[model samples]
Target chain A: MLFRLTREDWKVILYNLGRMLHLLSFVFLLPLVPALFYRELDTLSYFFFTSGFTLLLATLLSHLCRTDEQMELKHALCLVALAWLAASLLASLPLWLGGACSSPLDACFESLSGFTGTGLTLTVDPDHLARSLHFHRHLLQFLGDGVGIVAVSLAVLGRTEVSSLLAFRGEAREEGIRPSVVRTTRLIFGIALTFFVVGALMFTLAGIYEGADPGTAFFDGICHSFTGYATGGFSPHSQNLMYYHGLIYEVVAMVLAVVGALNFNLHYALLTGRRREVFRDTEVRVFFFTALLLGALTILLLLGKGIYTSTEALFRRGIFQLLSAQTTTGFSTVPPLHLSLVWPLSLLFLLSLAMLLGGCANSTSGGIKSLRVGILLKSLALELKRPFLPRSVVVGERFHHLKDSPLTPPVVRGAALVATSYLLLFAAGTLITMAYGYTAEQSMFETSSALSNVGLSCGLTHPSMPAGLKLTYMVLMWMGRLEVLTVLVLLIALALSFQRRKAE
Target chain B: MKRTLLCLLLCLSLLPCAGATPVSVEDLVRGPQEWDGRTVTVTGEVVGRLERGGHVWLNLLDNGWPLGIWCTKEQAEGIRVVGDYFHIGDRVEATGVFRARCPEHGGEPDLHAENLRVVLEGRRVPRPVNLLLLALSLLLLGAALSAALTLRFRRKEPFLGYSPESF
Candidate 1:
């Protein structure tokens, strides 16, 4: 019954399926490094077997369903949605077969964490896991997540101008890349590589200084680099970031996380001495002030609650956690329970707001994003300033650095699409979690964290959480990572195609 | 004499810091074994149906925690599984005295129980039926894969299609 498909649709599906296979094939290399490093051939062999088998199946299926043209916007969205679902399904092979996860849902959640770059983990006793599995998990976040939807959208934008705008505005800001979406993808990858190298070295040195075992230090360094650069808050130790307990490590982590949250195009401009653009960029200015102001407020809250006996600990811990949460990075120097009363609630609110006002467009951080918030705020200000202005003042004519012209309908609609989708996803997660015996504040915090790919949990996230909630969180992660439009498109296409088949 | 006394005092202060135990899961487990009757440690997966009472039984695990843990019903309080390994098959580490099995037990003679301490916990909850169901599901999935492969080959016959076979 599933065999019948239009040649045109088949072409798009097959072409995309081939790319998905290739991507999965590339991910096979992740486990090998750690397997070799830890001298565990059993795990390496398992990885080889599972990845080879999965990729082979993917390729065969794609070949059987070969299509023949450039994908339509609907098809592209369908492709991405299918790609993520298929990837998660296939990726679960390793965890399931290798016995890394006992339940299929748990495997799905962990993979979602990787693909979405939300560093929330369901694994227990991480220190004992096969080195290959741990490395594979981190590598997923490093590669798939680092190469974001915006970058991918731009890469494949090609002649599909409208689709590109839809994708760009739908997922992230369409303002980061210029005329060519493909070129932007390449640039993001290049910059990501640079950050990877620098972040890895710094983290490695810090690990060594902290007197971590040599082998563990190296592994931690790799994991931290990816997590830090992607603004994924995953940590290797059970205690999260508390195990390191070094001021220097915390400072470095904060810096790397902030770097991750910064807009890639802005970074590119600064490197190229396009300093003027940086100053005029509203998203950049807003992200900085929001982070700075929130950081100060958090510090004050901690002081007021008498959480820290010393001012130094107050500033250090406060700033670290604030930036970590704001950047949507889940790295915690201390568990939320240990903090002063005012701090946890304050951090939760600040972090939720940060997630709501995510990093700049074309960056790894998730949430509503700083860019959308900036646009919304600007739109509000314009409405308020309306009475003083002369008639026929077309305010939508505002120029952005990356966009060659003024804000177009597609651009505005795209942003609105993402904004609405994000809120809906958050709402769904919250409603489900609240039903599972959580407070509204706790539910909102967790839902926002999952939707933004921000892994911070206020003692609510647990492995034994209801299966329904885990599945919901997984869907949120997928939606959060892809943003809303792509998943929506996929759903619509699938429904339409099914209806057409039934009519026949 | 004062200089000697100062040195002694400094040494005394530094001694406690130097002798501070490295608090790792492994260390905690080994402690029970070494201490014997005096607060010895046993870190294994919790096993059995944990009772509402303070006492809990655990089936200790050796390595990676993805596997489920078993514990007796007595000591399940305060311990919550945090991941996917929540069956009798899950792996967990527990710290308790190595003692003789309870008279009610039909298993091995040397069973560890009573003063069981949960130093490090994992996400392995005990659900015996669920694990059996998982095994059955995997078996079904394998059968389906095989059937799909067989069907693909059977469809390759010339009578089934208009086109001639090609290598």
Candidate 2:
């Protein structure tokens, strides 16, 4: 063997991995509630089988790899990456078994999309899917994006220790709302659950008012609520938010998607009555300006083209699409094909930028995140003044994110690193997709959608799509969900760990 | 002169048929502006049904494209089986006023049906169970149960004395 891992290291990694499997097993059974309500015997049996298999696997791992050794940063990063992949694999079973997805690979793709909270669907017909399967699809997003897989696990484990802290910081987030990781994770889930309930109720009432039956309304309500707050935009109906044809429903969903994209610490501040943080936070300021600018340009283009004439058209289609794209939530009132065909190339380009910018860091939304964008812009603006000032003047960049934190070289470098990686990935993915006969605009839009973890499709994602491209989007989603660096870090660690050590 | 007059009258009479010729749901969805507020005919299967007070929404699917049809409750109640996991919905031909954005329904794209007729009745789709999968599921569950029981009874001390703690 070229290299060897100590028993302790393997123990730490596998033990935590086992803990996650245990959680996943429990998550697998949650769909049973809908299954029982709908009396879907086949669907009910699918969960029992999948959940049992997962429990067995979890038990075997826990039995084999019991350990007390604390995990380091490298182990945490590796675990975080592996956890996403493993959970997706285990989670795909139920959907695959339920016949929601046509093939095993497609099922895995759907599962990964849900787990990554990317919201891209490979299902042939989501509208006709079993209610339990649909519930599981949206539930995966809530756990994967809303509460966060590691955060929930930490909260469930209720361990007030550095190991939990390391795992929670696996996504490269350097701060938490509380000092204790367990307490912080609990608070995160607490906020998510409260929003989920409120959002679901609003959507339910709106659906009922719009003439939907009570059962269907409640079902759609909880599912949409899960996806919206998670910024994971899977819908029971293929038309997405357009299914209800209710402006109030779209309005409420837009609000929920934006709220989901907000930084959790910001949510905590508001919950604790620190209302000033909403206006003072630099990320919040940047997000609002970006939303307004993007929304206006998109609406202007649509109006100039004479595609939509009414004022309400802007509210329903233009602004709704902008929020969905900007927040990296993939809900759409317009069919996805229109983004490629009906919309002008300029609008597609504008929305591509929005998807790449995404929402706040440490939130459910994906992409490079607005905090990084804020920092990068702040640094560039300060740099522009440097050449004009005296040599003695040492310009310092500062921005408020939860609190006053100076834009140090490391912070700026960190932001730039992720953003640059994302852009490079976006370009590469676009080129690959374009090679498959899609136009540059279509390729860029869909590429941005996938790499940003936004589920919006320019009609490239379908069951009949080429297998190679499907695999490419899957990789993009996985790396994008981890924000590139964690996956990169895991790769580097793997390379280092596998190399032979020098004789001492 | 009589033949020419008769031909012109026939040509003019056939013009309305051009508007009612069946178009796919995707056609209206993709290019609603062309037919906005115009009487049109579409053919597809009902994927789902949602009931309002006096109206019902029949979401139709053709070529995997879905568009909602807003019709009288009487028009929708005739559909016995809608498309789902276990059944293929009834195929229907509906004539209505296609609105690119209906102001009455919050600017949503829909067709308010004036004439609805079922062309084909839907039937239940039987899904044969995969015995291999069923057996594998049972086997896996049995294994899990056995593992739990075996571990619980046989683990007073770590099997190899290198264990840490119980999960």
Candidate 3:
């Protein structure tokens, strides 16, 4: 029921729109770097020209409107939903115009992947493509992911409303470092930049030490750094992670991926010298524990399938895939489809779970998030424990590091909403994929990958994947990136608006 | 027994010369397009290669089909390119363009130059990060939208806290 929001809610939405417009303009500008480098004047001009016009429009619109108000949860969700659709449409301009992506559907998929941090690609020969195009792909992932709510919360117009902030925390961010939203956003950016810059340097060194071409290696370092920190996992190479065959490189990537998946609040805490807080945070603990357990299971499965006879190979490949998928990074050192069918299937399930859990709140990673998953699990456990407790007991349930957490009702509702949307998207993806004559398992895996914004595939993605399936994946990635609630609100709002029009 | 031993000795004697030529990949490429459907010999620097289904797909500079030479995984062992070089400039020959698609599909010979390669295997000058930064910055600056955000509430109140009439 979003019938009437406080006047302040309008202000919040408008402010966010202004921010989104700015974000979109910056995103469009990302492709130009590679375009200029590859000396593809056509692509370069395309990016520059579109970006200029788009920016001019956004600036004009932003200047024409002004408001100072708080945003409720519903309004915030609506803002997120509209922003996703609008940004995706705008992001497709370069691809749609550039001859590189011929079909509108393919362009949408590329844009969706770029925004959602899903690294899947429909391009046949990424290496042969102009350097600008190649860098544009990664640049999209870099910018779209680098700025999380926490990073930019501080940057948005000042003095957020308390009630709105509380509601926003439940849905939008896992942690707010201060009572003020702007401060939180600033802290987020600071931590993200540190990780990004440092991560890039490390990857570059690792690449050089392993005898990689300095130029390619440097570019790869930047792409991987952004992708890893964002947990987006879009690789520049078509072979994904398989192009590189170095032990240290995989290790470096894994570390960065994990760091990306971790909670930004934890980073803030660590940066502030809260060492004990890092250990005590329940989400961080569950995320790593789940990763380790899954990593072990995956290694065993790979070993059983004879994908790797040696323990060392099994450990290396298994750990990398686990981190990649668990973080929803989607990077892989092996051709995942080439793995034993059973193993890939299992890995897919684990990855799906990870994607569903997502990374920590207020970070670049998409999906439901580990913190929410942890809360859901705790809530479920409490329900089970209720019967054993005395009638007088208050239960006093608490999970660590979460302030103002939801009780059973809200948490259950949130989880169900997320689950329902995810399943629907996955189902839609499968149905469309089946039309392309993809096998059931392949369809399921590919859809799950797209919907989760986890780009692992079972040989189904290609330029030839039916336009319908491609579009479906685009919708899934868009929804996955924003989480389902925002999209659902948008859908419901549209439906209601149409009904009202009919009634009149 | 004597006849069998003599036959084995004759077959063994030819093995050394066979080893010397090493079944050149170049031989596979120049043989014939008619033989394209079958395995032939070709060798060049391994470049712009992608491996799938136990076959390694690569391009030779001289071929025009752009149809990749497909070699079994076993056949591709020990082959390596020194730099970021792939199909564009590597000098090794290839023998596997026999699988080239019919020209009707715009499929010419499987040999196509890759962006990474150059003649004599030299690399094109790489773009510096400053250049990259400038390009990316320019793109970002151009694409940004500065629209004022708008919030339109749903027409019907689905919960107790909100009401359509209140709007």
Residue A152 in candidate 2, Cα distance off native in Å? 1.9
lDDT, candidate 1, A1-504, per-residue tens: 342336577567555555455446546656877777766555654566555665556546645664436655555566666666777776776666656666777877887787788977776555446667777777767665776633353344323455444444444445544566556666777888899889988888886675454555677888888888988877765556654545666777888888898888878887898888877877777788888888778777666765544555665566776677778887876444333223456656766776766776678888877777766666667668878887887555464644434556675676677798888778888889999998777788888888888887766666777888888888888888777767876676677778888998
Better of 1 and 2 by lDDT: 2
Which has the greatest lDDT? 2
Which parts of model 2 are misplaced by more than 4 Å?
A1-8, A158-160, A497-504, B1-18, B29-39, B51-54, B97-108, B124-139, B152-167
Worst 10 residues of 1 chain B by lDDT: B100-109
Question: Could you list the CA RMSD of all candidates, in the order they appear?
Answer: 12.8, 4.6, 10.8
Q: Give the Å error, residue A205, model 1.
A: 1.0
What is the C-alpha lDDT profile of model 3 across B1-167, one tens digit per residue?
99999999987854332323223433433443444455344444333454445555453422221224445556545445422312233445443224322232122223221111222442343423345634764655534321212222322411113344563
TM match of model 2 to true structure? 0.91
Report the Cα lDDT for residue B12, model 1.
Answer: 82
* Model 2 chain A lowest lDDT segment of ten: A495-504
Query: Native contacts retained per candidate?
Result: 0.01, 0.41, 0.08
- List, residue by residue over A1-504, the lDDT tens digit for candidate 2: 232445577677777787677778768889989877876656766887987888788778877897767777767777888788889998999889888889999999999999888999998887678889999999999999888886568556523477678778885455689987778888888999999999999999988887777878899999999999999999998888878877778899999999999999999999899999999999999999999989989889988987676888778888898899999999988878777766778989999999999999999999889899999999999988899999998889789988799989999999999999999999999999989998999999999999998999978899999998999999999999998887887676566566534432
After aligning candidate 2 to the native by TM-score, how far in Å is the CA of B55 from where it should be? 3.9
Question: Over all chains combined, what TM-score does candidate 3 have?
Answer: 0.74
Across B1-167, the per-residue lDDT of candidate 1 in tens digits comes to: 99999999989854533423322333433232343223233344432222223433332444421111224555455555422222333333343333211123211112344333455555533322344444544454455345434544565522112223442
- Chain A only: give the TM-score of model 1: 0.90
TM-score of each: 0.72, 0.91, 0.74
